[model samples]
Target: MGTKTALITGANSGLGLATAKALAQRSFDLVLLCRSDQKGREAQADVQKANPAVTVDYFIADLADLDSVREAAGQITAKYPQLDVLINNAGYTPARLEFVDGIEKSFYASHIGHFVLTNHLLGSLKAAGAGANGPARVISLSSAAYLGGRAARFFRKIDDLSPTFAYCDDKLANLLFARELARQTAGQGVVSYSVHPGAVRTRFGADTPGFLGKVFSLAGPLMRTPEKGAQTSVFLASAPMKSIGERNNGGYFADSAPKNTHNRDINDEKAAWLWEKTMPFV
Candidate 1:
């Protein structure tokens, strides 16, 4: 039998690439997605070269654009029926406010695009669930910033949206979305999880403010490596974890262990409300 197949988005660099490497090391077939074709191809080559026996493929999908998301999801679904894992790891933290299709910037890329792509790939994940190994999992990356002190207070209201609190709000949306998705897919062999990778050294913060971005830029020594950053994400998707019923279905994880989420509003009702509000755009 072939090794299980796993698809990771934003796989050109950072946590996504590191996760790909970890999975390849375990002999999992890889499908890597990136916004740029050139970069995606390069990442694919790098992975394949590292593990000559593993199969690594690449797809181009700009999570910032809904059309690209849909097309990429469709392509993946058409080609692969049983996806053992789906890692929604792509993100964009723009320095300046930007909008796509009239929606806020961070909200669109971090939450809406992943939601749409996950929904589109639901059938394939379900197919994988039917196999002997039980259900397939969908792992979405959240952030410790979701509960980052007073800065988190700004994201209490989902309707009170803006560009400044864009990343914070979107991460909150990720938690809410994961909860509701777990509810909707209950007993279907498809479970959803949101995770915080901790404060890692990555290019994910290349667009932050003056000293902050610079300090984040030079964080290789002070912060965890990308492989360490990907531990919880990969574990949520592939680890033979402990009991995970509906109570923990949409649960959030950190440091490769389940942690109590500080975001109290990430319940079913809130997820449903946010879903209704953004359903039209996604």
Candidate 2:
């Protein structure tokens, strides 16, 4: 196979780092988009330490910040003509209410940034699809917390952004974005998938306050380790595109398997609606 490149956001730690390491093992040259130089460098060294043969590189980009995302995306596309995998795996639970251009910070971090970044990199992804790989994959990390966000509640009541509610909405948005992206790129040799990595014990919410923080502290044994949580994402990225496509070009997965979601709210209408609303932000 020709050189395969994968770009991952929020790759400093948690599921993102686990996924990066796993992909590195698969011989993928990595480009990790992180928010800090120190963290990015540390992650770069960590991945290289684990897989010396693979080329591991890192760039700084905050998922909630537009300029940073654009600059990183440009660098990625310029560096690689073929980007085989893109895992939109960075998610944050806002410690407090915040917004970027009126969009809730949590929502921006989870969905909008990925949205813009994906759109910007579509050229490279499609280029890879047209190569020997022939079906470039975009795997986005969403949560089953989407179950908490019903269609009726999404993208409404914009002003009062509750951290919890924002989390739910963004995950819902991730699923919807994956579906819509698959729809848009159906015949272009590009496929997108949304993943629920299960409840993994990671430092993502280590700073969360109150009951949620207590849950993180006390639920260590109950949650899967980051490596264990990364199985589905790794599976989706490495699986034969034909098999994956047969199941669903844009499917939701969990437990390392493609799942058929019964949530009525997870529909094309909602997906398109989200895609429409997201255009302006980018």
Candidate 3:
């Protein structure tokens, strides 16, 4: 690849859009994925206008729909010989229990959907990693809410799911997915990391039900701006591998630093389990 490429999910707005701007500023060609085509093109133009030298492309894909994710990934891998960065940043919380292809809707949006996309693009990521600017990076956006994650094994059926609870559990799944990807791809020149982009006030959870939704809607004044929240993501996308440290592979990061947390649920065992449990879906 003449210039590095980054593929980001939910890139039409919020943290994803902000991250795309930052990466474009750093001269990376962007392949943005969004559910709405109009917003995707608008964001693409925003990034392209800001950094005229870089390429900004968009694909319309709903993470809730497995077929859509796969179709988008197919185009991406077909067009790009290698992908230098993959930001699994798309996330959403349904107001109540819902399903797409028999899986929980929020869980599908936050985890399984990205799972399929990443699986499809793994080849391109590995190709980039093994090349000159070796070790392609996979960055998943998680949240501190992961601490409250249920670890319910997302594939299982739950009679009811609160928006808040769904978010927490799915966030944990983000970390596990990253860790498992790192382990399976070890020594393959691809690295995975999960990030907690602190409570950036975005419309991401506008539809969240009840008290949590109220907090997200009213707490905008206290929350970090999208640009500020995207800093760690930009750092992870552009930093030297040595600076990130190889030991910290499959790490979780917040505030631009690796979080060596004591959370037992965020361990390799759980990561492996999640991988195995979700493999059939992919």
Candidate 4:
């Protein structure tokens, strides 16, 4: 049998790296996609050392830049020709608000880039096929922060992206994208799902506000380690979508279990809107 291929973005550290390690342990060949050249080199060495038998490849691309994402997708598709799994784990959170191509940073990196890359590489993922067993899978990393407690009540408007609000919007966007992707790719033998990897002790929360950032930082003692955090991502990668319910077809999971996705705006209409708006840039 041919070795299965798995590509993980931001695989240099934290949840992405941990997931890479787990996949390596499973003996799957790896394609580690990172924006940082130095970190990618270090991770290549580390993963190679740990899983000497598995072929590991590296590609560098900043997902926020559409050109970079397209280039990366073209290169990966040309080289690998067959891709079994795609984990969209790369993200950007700034201490101060930022934008890429005039859109919110979180929206650009978390949703737009991955959205385009998936489309660009859709053929390769299809080439891998479902076979008799199952199809290639795509795991998109969302965040629990989008659940917004009661604060979500005020999120009815798209213009409400004040400060941290954009992050929530983007995370919700992930769920919407996954759902539409499932519908679009149904029976094509390629599945896509979104996930909240639990609030692991990672650098993600460092840019958050006030006591929240500190509290998140201090969670090193209590929060799930990166390995534990990445289990659901791995599960989505390897598990059969049907067993997890229809929700798994285009829904959200947390900690390896199905969960109620948080937004009514995440309906088909909104997803189509996002897709149309993004088609030009992708």
Across 1-282, the per-residue lDDT of candidate 4 in tens digits comes to: 226889999999999998998888877788999997898899988888768999888999988888998999999999977788999898665455566656667677788889898999888888887555358888888888666422232224334355455666677777777878888888897888889988787776677765556667787678888999999998887665566665467778897988886555767877677667667776
* lDDT minimum window of 10 residues, candidate 1: 148-157
Across 1-282, the per-residue lDDT of candidate 2 in tens digits comes to 215788888888999999989988888889899999999999999988778988998988888888889998899889887899999999888777677776677887788899999999999999999988778999999988787665565545476556666777788889999999999998898998999999899888778665556777798889999999999998888877665656577889999778877677899899998899888867
TM-score leader: 3
Off by over 4 Å in 2: 151-160
How far residue 92's Cα lies from its native spot in candidate 3, in Å, is: 0.3
Better of 1 and 2 by lDDT: 2
Model 3: per-residue Cα lDDT over 1-282, one tens digit each:
127999998888899999999998888999999889888879989989768998888988998888888898899888987999999999887788887777778888889988888989999999999999889999999888888786764776676667787788889999899989999999998999999999898888887778779989998899999999999999999999888888988999999899975566877788898998877767
Model 4 lDDT, full chain set: 0.78
Listed in order, each prediction's TM-score against the native is: 0.89, 0.94, 0.96, 0.89
Model 4, residue 209: distance off in Å is 4.1
> Candidate 2 — which pairs collide?
none
Model 2 Cα displacement at 96 (Å)? Answer: 1.4
Tens digit of per-residue lDDT, candidate 1, span 80-184: 888988998886665765666566667678888888888889999999988876588888887876653232332243444433356666677777777787888
Off by over 4 Å in 1: 148-164, 210-220, 243-247
Residue 66 of model 3: what lDDT?
A: 83
